[model samples]
Target: MSDKQLTELLSLINQRQDRLAFACKEIADWIDSQGDRPVAGKIRDSLKAVEADEVLVKKTLTSLTLERPLPRFR
Candidate 1:
């Protein structure tokens, strides 16, 4: 695919990741309200990796858009 298409796809993936993270947080909040602090904490901890991966995705997207052109994939 072209670089432009790849960038768009990555952008969409990043957006989905953000939404997933938001949903997870909402679920965690509900669980905490239900007095399951441990489960909620675990959920929050698990989100750490998702959050970190988000940063990496953002960086890669930036590089893909701004750096030299990449070879088109078949």
Candidate 2:
């Protein structure tokens, strides 16, 4: 692939990361707004885990795309 294509792909990845972060924040905020309910705490904990996983995935993707060169196969 060409450099232009790689740049475009990276841009898209960044946009997606932004959107995912926004959605996760919205969910967390909604959960917090819901007063001290029995399940609210559990749900908030689960969302936290999901957010952590997202960060890991995004880091991996950024490393794979920006830090390392892509291999060309015959």
Candidate 3:
């Protein structure tokens, strides 16, 4: 891949991270707004937990990407 492609890939990775952060915020808001027992609340809480413990997710993504070859591979 050219330098341009690599830069684009890194930009996409950053965008993905930003999207995850946005998802976490949305879930947290939903959880806070729930008054009664709601299944959505459970899902929201789960998302919050995952967002709070993102180190594992980061490591996994990094390891997986590092092990994969670039698109230019034969």
Candidate 4:
């Protein structure tokens, strides 16, 4: 795929991830309110991984959009 396409794909993926993370946090809050602190903590811990992955995705998208493209090797 072309760089432009890759950038677009990454952007979409990032948006989806953001939405999922938001929804998960909401659920975690509800779980905590219900007194299931352990499950809520687990959900939050899982969210940390998602947050890290989001950083990497953002970095990749930035590189794709801001850096010059490498020459094709064909």
Candidate 5:
């Protein structure tokens, strides 16, 4: 694939990841706003964990976009 296409794909991937991260944070905030401390803490922790994954996704995406494309498995 051409560099432009790869760049565009990476941009879209980043955008989607950003949205997913934002949604997770929003959900976590909503959960925190509710009463039930224990339940909210647990759920918030899980959501935070998932939100943290966005960092790894961004790093990997950057590496993939900057480096040569990997060979596809047959």
Candidate 6:
């Protein structure tokens, strides 16, 4: 992919990570308020995905930064 495209994708990926983190935190808080249960366990698993997404985003950013492409003027 072109550098511009990669940059845009990185921005989107980071944005998604941020959103997921916010949602996961809120869900965890709600679960805590509701008391421990089987459902809370499931919610915790989803929160773990947010952590994974952060790692994925970091990987994507590393790959994007290591790549080089022809410059485009607009």
Question: Candidate 5: which pairs clash?
Answer: none
Question: For residues 1-61, could you state the per-residue lDDT of candidate 6 as single tens digits?
Answer: 8776877887886888788778877887787788965676787777787777777778877
Q: Which candidate leads the pack in TM-score?
A: 4
Tell me how many clashing residue pairs each candidate has.
Answer: 0, 0, 0, 0, 0, 0
| Residue 17 lDDT (model 5) | 65
Mind giving the per-residue lDDT tens digits that candidate 5 earns over 2-69?
87687789779779867876776677678677765676667667767667777787787676667676
Q: Report the C-alpha lDDT of model 1 over 46-71, residue by residue, as the tens digit.
A: 99999878767888999889868557
Off by over 4 Å in 4: 67-74
Q: Write the number of the candidate with greater TM-score, choosing between 3 and 4.
A: 4
Off by over 4 Å in 1: 67-74
lDDT of 2: 0.67
Model 2 is weakest, by summed lDDT over 10 consecutive residues, at 35-44
For every model shown, what is its TM-score relative to the native structure? Answer: 0.84, 0.49, 0.43, 0.85, 0.53, 0.60
Higher-scoring candidate on lDDT, 1 or 6: 1
RMSD of each: 3.9, 4.5, 6.3, 2.3, 5.0, 5.3
Worst 10 residues of 6 by lDDT: 61-70
lDDT of 3 at 72: 88
| Candidate 3: tens digits of C-alpha lDDT, residues 1-74 | 96556656865876687688677667766766775347556656666665775776566556545545558856
Model 1 — which ten-residue stretch has the worst lDDT?
A: 62-71
